[model samples]
Target chain A: MKKFFLGFALVSLLIAGVLSYFASGDPDGLDKTVEDTGIAAHAQEHPFAGSTFADYALGGDSKFTGLAGALGVIVVLAVSFSLFWFLRKRPDAR
Target chain B: MHMSDGLLNAPVSVAFLVIAAVGVGFALVKARADLDDRTAPMAGLVATFIFAVQMINFPILPGASGHLLGGALAAILVGPYVGALCVTIVLVVQALLFADGGLTALGANVTNMALIGTATGFVVAVALRRLAERGKGGLAAVAFVSAFVNTVVAATGFVVEYAIGGAGGVEIGKVALLMWGLHALIGIGEGLITAATVTSVAAIRPDLVYLLRGSRKPLEVRS
Candidate 1:
């Protein structure tokens, strides 16, 4: 089970690390719909829009997409894993 | 879909924040039922995988692309409660660190993508799984349909929120039609990606798949 979990996490990291760079730059479905309907103008700047990893780019540079993605995966993995680790059922208590 | 800050009025936004809090708080408590020491890591991995996949946007139409919402995918892989929490975790991280979603609009995004999407997908899967034949293919098919429906229903969630307190002057009917249509196309991508991933995991370690737990299909591979 440990090996399987490691392999799964590795594959996810690989995808986020590498494949994310090739994702299309086009607007997503919701974005495109809002654009078409002209409601996009109502969309406000996110508070953290100027952050390092905003828009999945590092320092607003598209060249660093893979790095940004890898970092995101790591952060998400760490935070979520810690949460689940603490929350998991303890059989010994019973 | 991730709503920006100005898309909704303050009242509606606050309402959803409360709504999201109650919903997520409920899920957080309920998630324990699904998580044993052995399966907790699986739930975490599901969160990471969904985050990774969401970064890759596959083109759906001429000017539109779609990414995996992963609510259905997570729900199918993990149980629904844990799956909702997984998606909520991703949305929180994205909103705070990545700015992929709005901070003020976080509640709405959580409600739509995490709660509504996961519940829809799980319900759809449960309804159809019994009718689906006992094979990996059957499981994959159910996953596909479940994910497809999840996307559409979640899209409806956005439209409902929009109707309540949309800041723009756009027609509600028009927005509804456009959202539903675009998401319908996007849902196909969601279905295919979900089916492929679920099938692969089920093939390698069928025991880890929560959706397949009730089936007595006697899968040949379990490592």
Candidate 2:
């Protein structure tokens, strides 16, 4: 059962990573509205813009970027699960 | 919507972080009361489902594509606190790992999509459920309205941020109206999916649905 859950999470994360890359880079509804109304340019640059993972890509080829993206999701999920699992008190372990 | 870093003014961004922190603090307390072994797994599963559903983008008009925000859906299926936590976790993961949203913008994204969206949606759901007397159909309606409200609220947040840190002179009113109108349409899609998902969960494990508390009518009255 645990393996099944883990497998499901892995597959979902991979799909999410790939689809995220394909998501419309064009301003979304909010962005479009902002642009049309002339406030779109008001956005400031993030202080952390120089970070390696600043954008979706990590300064690599598209395929390589996609793989990195997928791995990132897996790592995040694993870390989150571990934190929650550890914090969780066992019925008697507590 | 994932607002990337440098998207909003520092003050506005910092303000949102404060709001998000309060909401998260509240959620932590609430979750402790509501979460059990079963609820924890259910929340995790719901998060995964949200991740999947968000991938299927539907065209907004001719070219623009928008996907499920999942705040309302998560809040309704699980308790509000847990729902907020689930969506926030997803956003955090997306930002740090996938770089889907900007790292610096993580706080703003969580505030808009997770805190404001979930709180507004949950409130709407509660109101709608009360009006409908907990009828099965009521759950669907609540989900729809909640999702719609959340999207609108998120859009409004963006407008406010722009007003504070606009690049140059621009009309805020027009921008607000335009964003609000387009998001209303996007909200419809969010609403439908949330309603559908909530209805499905209510059908199978009605008990799992947090928004359907005392309102759930007896399936069959004792003779």
Candidate 3:
């Protein structure tokens, strides 16, 4: 079980850190809908747009974006692990 | 789809935030009561996996792309309650850390992606699985259909929210049509990914799949 968990975590890291660099650069479905319908004009910048990792890019470098992606995955994992750890029903581990 | 800030008026955004909060609150309670040691780890892992995959977009057209929503995928792997919570966690992180989703519109995104998507997908998948009355392959087929339908439904959710609180002059009807149509294509990719993942996991660790729980019958894998 531990092996499977480790392997899965490693795979997730690779996908976020490396494969994410290959993701398409086009607007996503929602963004395209906004643009095609002329609603893009009303779209405003996200409140956190100026954050170091805003838009998943950092320091104007693609490599930084990859680093950001990996960091995001790890952060999410850690946070979620903590949340689930506290919330999950543990029936007295034998 | 991550709805950005200013897309919907303040009233609309607040309303969704309230709604999403209620849904998430309920899910948190339910998931807490239901999760075990095994499922606890699976839930965290599923959320992490989803966060990673959501970064990878596949092109649907010349200038458009879509990524995994992962609501159905999570619900099938874990339970619906845990699945919704997982998605909510991912969305929260994306909004706060990556700014990938809008901060003010976080509520709206949570409602569409986490609440509606997981609820609809889980219900549909379970219904179809029972109807199919087959085995592993059939479960995967059902997962595909449910995930596809969930994406469409979630997209429709945005359209509904937009109509209520549209900040732009765009025609709501046209926007709905485009959103639904494009999302249908995106949903195809979601279905394929969900199906493949569910099938793979079901093959090796069928016990881990929430959908297949409590089944005494043999799950014949049709090659």
Candidate 4:
């Protein structure tokens, strides 16, 4: 069970990493709607916009940043999966 | 559709936040009955699948591309509450980690795409399932219709938000109409994919399809 979850977590993170590259830079439905409606500029920059992890890229444009983003996703997924597993794993809890 | 912060008026945003909070609470409560050891992993896996599939985009018009919102898909495959929770988790992750959506707009996105879309889709699916009870190939049809309706509804939600906070003087009616029309077409694509996915799962594991419960026994054709 542990192995299955660990594998699932790793794979989920890997999928996120790969998809992040192909995700459309074109504005999504909401963004396009706002732009078409002329309210696009009204959108606020996120408070975390200055974070290195913002925009799915690491700080520098080096290959390291890309690799870091992928690794970071893995780390987050691992933690999230672990937390869920721990909470739900209690035999009597369910 | 992710409505970023400042894209919606404070009133509208707050309204959605309240709505989302209630929806999440309801989902958490309802999902308790459905969250067995087996179903838990399945729920997680289904969420992952939806997340992966959402990356595949189809062109909307000449230059626009849209991806699967998957609220209806999840709701039909899983229960409504679980469906809402799954999509909410996906949206939250997208906003915080992938930066695909805005953090401040999380509540609005959850309300529109997760709560409204999933609940409406589940209701539609339930109604259609009842209607198609004894018919062959009915499950697929219901799944398609549910997905279609969900997308259209979410698109409408987007238009309403824009009308309230539109920094531009564009006519609200025009924006609403245009968004609705385009999304109607997009809804068809969503319906097809969702129907295909749901029907495939129903064929193998009908028990996994919460919406199709009590509809009919799965057919087994032996060669």
Candidate 5:
């Protein structure tokens, strides 16, 4: 089970690292809707727009962006595992 | 669909934030009851995997693309309670770390993608699973259908939110119609990926798929 999970996690990391670079750069459904409806004018910049790694990349370099994407996956894994670890029922407790 | 700030007024934003917080909190408590050591990592993996998948957007129409929402897929893999919690964490991480969704609009996003999406998808999958015969392609087919429906419902969620709190000048009905139409296309992509993923996992790790648990049976000996 651990081996399978590790492989699964590795595959996910690869997709995020490599395949994400090939993802369409076009605006997504909501963004396109805002543009089509002329509501794009009302969309405000995120308060953290200037933060490091904003938009999932640092300087628009493809390699850096890919690395950042991989890092994002790891960060999510770590955080979620931490949360679930606490929330999981311990069999020995009862 | 990650809505930025200013799309909704402060009151509407606050209202959704409160609602989403309560919903997620309830999910956490509920999930804790069912989550054991073995299942805990599964839930975490679902969240992590979906976060990575969400980055890859496929073009649905001219100049418009969509990404995996992962609500239905997660619900089908794990149960709905943990599924919702997983996606909520993904949304929170996206908002705070990547800024994919607006910080102010986090509540609305969570409500749409986490609460409503997973709930509807799980219910739909279970209903379809019941209607179909066991141990065939039925489970995978229902997974696709559930995922497709999940996206449409989530899209409608945005429409409802916009109606209640839209700051733009566009007609509410028109936006709703367009949102629905565009998401229908996006839902196709969502459905296909979900079907493929669920089927793949069911093939290798059938025990991991909560929706398929009932359908699995011991191999029969020929007379």
Candidate 6:
């Protein structure tokens, strides 16, 4: 079971690290809808616009998208795993 | 879809934020019943996978692309309560660290993708449990339909939010129609990816699939 999970996590990390670089840079559905409807003009830059890893990259550089994505996967995994660790029901209880 | 901070008005944003907080809080409490040694790890892995797949935006139309929302996939695999937590965690992380979703609009995003998306998907998955337990193909079909509907329903959530307090000159009707059309196309991609992933997971270890817990198809080997 551990091996299966590790393999699954490894594959996910690889996809985020490698294939994410090849993802289309075009606007997503919502963005494109807003743009097409001309409502995009009303969109505001989020407060996190100046975040260190804004737009899923280091310094908003495209070259580091893969690295950024991989880091995000790790962070999300760690956070979720830790959260569930405390939340999970112990067998001895009921 | 990750909406920016500017898309919604402050009042609407705050309202949705409160709604998201309630929904996520409820899920946090409910998730305890679903999480055990096996599913705790499974839920964590599902969340990581969602974060990873969300980065791979596939082109759906001329200039529009879409990515896996993962609501249905997560719900089917780990049960809806834990699934909602997984998605909320990803959304919160993305808003805070990755700048993927807007900080102000985080509540709306969570409400749509985490609460609405997972709830609808889980409902559909449960409704089709018999078919989903038939075989891998059956499960994939159920996954695809649930995911497809999840995307569309989640997109409709945005439309509803926009109708309530949209601060733009665009016609509400236009927003609704375009959103539906675009999301329909995006949903197809979401469906395919979800089907593939769910089928693959069910094939290897059916025990991990929450929706398939009582199915008579695959024999579970206790590890």
Per-prediction DockQ: 0.83, 0.32, 0.82, 0.32, 0.80, 0.84
Candidate 2 residues B1-223, lDDT tens each?
Answer: 7776666667767777787788888777777656666566667766766755565567787656577778888888776888888788778766664556666567677887888888888888777767434555776778888999998997787777768764455677877788788888889999998888777667666666787666557422111
The DockQ assigned to candidate 5 is 0.80
Point to the candidate with the largest DockQ: 6
Query: Per-residue CA lDDT of candidate 1, range A1-94, in tens?
Result: 7788899899889888899988977888778877888888989999898998898888899898888889989999999999988988888876
Each model's number of backbone clashes? 0, 4, 0, 0, 0, 1
Model 5: chain B TM-score vs. truth?
0.94
List, residue by residue over B19-116, the lDDT tens digit for candidate 6: 99999899999999999998899899999999999999999887889888889988999989899999999999998998788888999999999989
Candidate 2 Cα deviation (angstroms), residue A22: 8.0
A2-56: candidate 4 lDDT, tens digit per residue: 5544564555566555654655556655566677767777878876666666555
Global fold similarity of model 2 (TM-score) = 0.80
Q: What share of the true interface contacts does each candidate keep?
A: 0.78, 0.28, 0.83, 0.27, 0.72, 0.83
The candidate, 1 or 5, that scores higher on DockQ is 1
Global Cα RMSD, each model: 1.5, 4.2, 1.8, 3.9, 2.4, 2.0
Docking category of candidate 2:
acceptable
- True-structure lDDT of candidate 3: 0.87
CA shift of B213, model 1, Å: 1.5
Q: Give the alpha carbon lDDT tens digit for every residue of B171-221 in model 4.
A: 888778767777787788889988887776665566667775665654331
What lDDT tens digits, residue by residue, belong to model 5 across residues A12-52? 89888888989988888888887888777887798877767
Interface CA root-mean-square deviation for model 1: 0.9
Residue A25 lDDT (model 4): 53
Measured with C-alpha atoms, the lDDT of residue A86 in candidate 5 is: 91
Give a tens-digit lDDT track for model 6, residues A1-94. Answer: 9988998899889988999988988888888888888878888877776877888889978799889889999999999999998899999975
The residue ranges of model 5 lying beyond 4 angstroms of the native Cα positions read A60-63, B131-133, B216-223
Lowest summed lDDT window (length 10), candidate 3 chain B: B214-223
Better of 1 and 2 by DockQ: 1
Predicted model with the maximum lDDT: 6
Question: Model 4: runs farther than 4 Å from truth?
Answer: A1-25, A57-94, B130-136, B164-166, B219-223
